[model samples]
Target: MDMEERVVGEVLVVRPVGKRIDASGSADFKGKMVDRINRGRNLIVLDLSDVDFIDSSGLGAIVSMLKTLGKKGELRIGGLKETVDSLFRLTRMDRVFRIHPSAEEAVLALAAAKSMAKAPA
Candidate 1:
């Protein structure tokens, strides 16, 4: 799986340029995410606009990424196609991830959350 990684403010945006995230790409996807997290990227936004399909392994890899982040980081998903959206909804993974219509929206939301966290009580 080929992914483009960039930073927008404090969020790390990872856009995977692949039509399907199945058994073949799941490991790569998970590894990329883990690498970002290990490198001190606490805010991650996955841009999945190009991904049209994902299998159980792919979903499991995403869940594993979330678990790896734990309370130290956060993961958000954006630009989900119909097939991918249905899979997430059907599997109740939508509730586990913060889904957005676009990567820009996810970045904005994450930025707001970061600001809020830094705000003084």
Candidate 2:
């Protein structure tokens, strides 16, 4: 599992540079995410542009990450390929997460939300 991590104004952008996230890569993906979370990086935007295929294990790993984040953080996904997007929609995971058209949009949206939360009422 190859992943690139970058911080975009409080949102951690994680781009997995792989064609598939199946049983073989799920554990590595989950471990890397957990390590980041344990390191105190909360808000995340998973960029799946390079990922063309995913299996149940990959989906499960993502859900697990969301659960681990819980109330302390947010997990948004972006750049999903058509097949991956269909899977998320079919599994109703799309409703469970904020799916963005692009990573830039995801990061900007999260940043805006953060700014709004900190604004004086």
Q: For model 1, how does the per-residue alpha-carbon lDDT over 1-121 read when each residue is reduced to its tens digit?
A: 8988899988999998888889998998899888889989989999999888999999999999899899998888889998889999999988889999998899999899989999999
TM values, all candidates? 0.96, 0.97
lDDT scores of the candidates, listed in order: 0.91, 0.92
Q: Once superposed on the true structure, which residue ranges of model 1 sit more than 4 Å away at CA?
A: none
lDDT of model 1, residue 69: 91
Best-matching candidate per TM-score: 2
- Say which candidate scores most in lDDT: 2
Question: Candidate 2 residues 1-121, lDDT tens each?
Answer: 9988899878899999988999998999999999999999899999999999999999999998999899999998889988899999899988899999988888988888888988999
